[model samples]
Target: MLTKEAFNALLKTLEEPPENIKFFFATTEPQKVLPTIISRCQRFELKRISNELIIEKLSAISKDLEREIEKDALYQISNFSEGSLRDAQSLLDQIFCYSDGKITLEYVNNALGFIDPDFFFELDNQISKANTSFAFEFVNKVHSLGKDLSYIIEELIEHFKNLLIIKFNSKTSKFLSETILKKYVLSSALYQEEELFYILETLTQATILHKNYFKKIHLETVMLKIIKSKNVLSLDILVKKVN
Candidate 1:
């Protein structure tokens, strides 16, 4: 029977507790409590429980599934949980329900399809479509997938690297699959191999810069600069800023 007025009375109780009495309080959001009350109480902040401890608790709770939950699958789930024991447990419960009491990587990936395959296709189509809106939409969709922008930049650089490699050597071409290699072989003809190599180098440097302190906005600008500069022949002259 804790009403607002009665709740305020707790301060009085706290100021002078009765003999042989004990009290404990808990709250998820402590900011709502008055500052004076908070100052008087001993604060105990709970740290995020480790993955190992979470597995221990889950093992204790479900002795039947202890061995299965203790494996690598739980570690992956804990990573996805972002350091919340309760969230990790909830994820494990959902996974158990869907996986028929077994945990596997395949089940985890299926549950979290955070990326789209069409992301590669849309970027590939950009050369032909030459549409600004499509480029913006595709880049934004990539950002929304919770992927690090640096990874996306690395993927693009690799794509262009494959194309450049295919362009330079016809016999070395067997490394690529028949379908994707064919596309690269065709696309490579548009630029000199030296020029393509320079662009690839620029992209690699940009990817490194992206990892350090550059914001997404600045990274995007640098990526666009590399893409637009594909027409330039001299790699040395283009990277004056880096020098």
Candidate 2:
């Protein structure tokens, strides 16, 4: 039997009058629990650990890993973690595993596996020689890399968001090299800024939908929507158009 069910059974046994018998339930989510069960117990709320404590824990782990933890990386983990020490630790663990413990701003970028500038540039170059088959094949390769379709879409959105930031304020946002994005700037300039904004919004929405449910048809539809809206045509089409 589940522990919860056993606990509930034990509660029944205690319903009458068992002297010196006590039970306690601890949960992050109490609202989902039974109020009747809660009524019988003395409740004690635990204070959440502060951010400074969480950073100290993270710094300790970084020392153990023999890695230099940069401020930007800490900021990324902090932003994504929403003040949960465990979540921040878990994020650091994933990042170190993904990057093999060499932590840097680039390492953070690589851990997330954002779009490669060279690949996008080469993609632009290949437009002339590429065929539609290449685009479908590229999607398959991306799938084989153990990344979910939703994650890939989210990465694309994040990359473009960085680009948009760079476009507006060149000095402040250096997540991407200005040299690499210049090509995209040239290409993106052809379209109205409104269109690019629409594409980003669409990708974000698609990511949300895909994460809610894993549907192959829905994934393909999102990809096709991206291809059409972004003027990518096909893998081949992108190569030729950009070339």
Candidate 3:
């Protein structure tokens, strides 16, 4: 944002700068900067930090600080940060203050008022199976438990992504074991890539539309959409035509 006064004051110095003085300007939003200033300065772009790298650094920092944060907790912070190392570290700092050293995924969830990941997994499983009855029942439970619908939608997107990974990978995990991974691998077969993409898009769009309040009617509609998604393809079962 270039105010007229600021720009005018800088214009003289930039146009006839002293040899000893170097002016460096930095902004997260380069588009807001004046085009004239942009043309005059040497520009550098900083890319987003990767989650794994951030997690790796957080793990080291936690150990050095004797925090002993769990792996899932770090993963949760990494996922929450979305590639901002500063945000991730800030979240870790919050968790550290809240936990006083011993950090676990459940602790993080409770601290953040977030529901368990397993709830989202159950919801995803029922949806992938097209079990509308169970799906709606689960929603009722969620309502009774008073979980945040917005957060559920956010976590559900991540749940679907994990299932998508199981489709192509054959690795076991310290948390999600070989047996569970194999199960998600089977569940992943129930959905097409396009179907998952559509579900993610729809859920995200629906989530964005909700106000500061929870509406069962809106969630119910999303459940129906999940159950009867138009993008679904029968990949798990084969049907032969009668001759």
Q: Which of candidates 1 and 3 is the stronger one according to lDDT? A: 3
Instruction: Give the residue spans of candidate 3 off by over 4 A.
Output: 1-13, 16-19, 141-148, 168-190, 204-208, 211-214, 229-243
Instruction: Write down the worst ten-residue block by lDDT for model 3.
Output: 234-243
The alpha-carbon deviation from the true structure for residue 93 of candidate 2, after best TM-score superposition, in angstroms, is 5.6
lDDT of 2 by residue, 134-169 (tens): 455556766776666666676667655654665565
Off by over 4 Å in 2: 1-4, 10-24, 41-57, 60-66, 79-82, 90-101, 105-141, 154-197, 204-224, 227-243
Q: Per-model C-alpha lDDT, please?
A: 0.62, 0.60, 0.72
Question: In candidate 1, which residue ranges exceed 4 Å CA deviation?
Answer: 1-135, 235-243
| Per-model TM values vs. the true structure | 0.42, 0.48, 0.75
Task: Give the Å error, residue 81, model 1.
Answer: 26
Candidate 2 at residue 222, lDDT?
A: 59
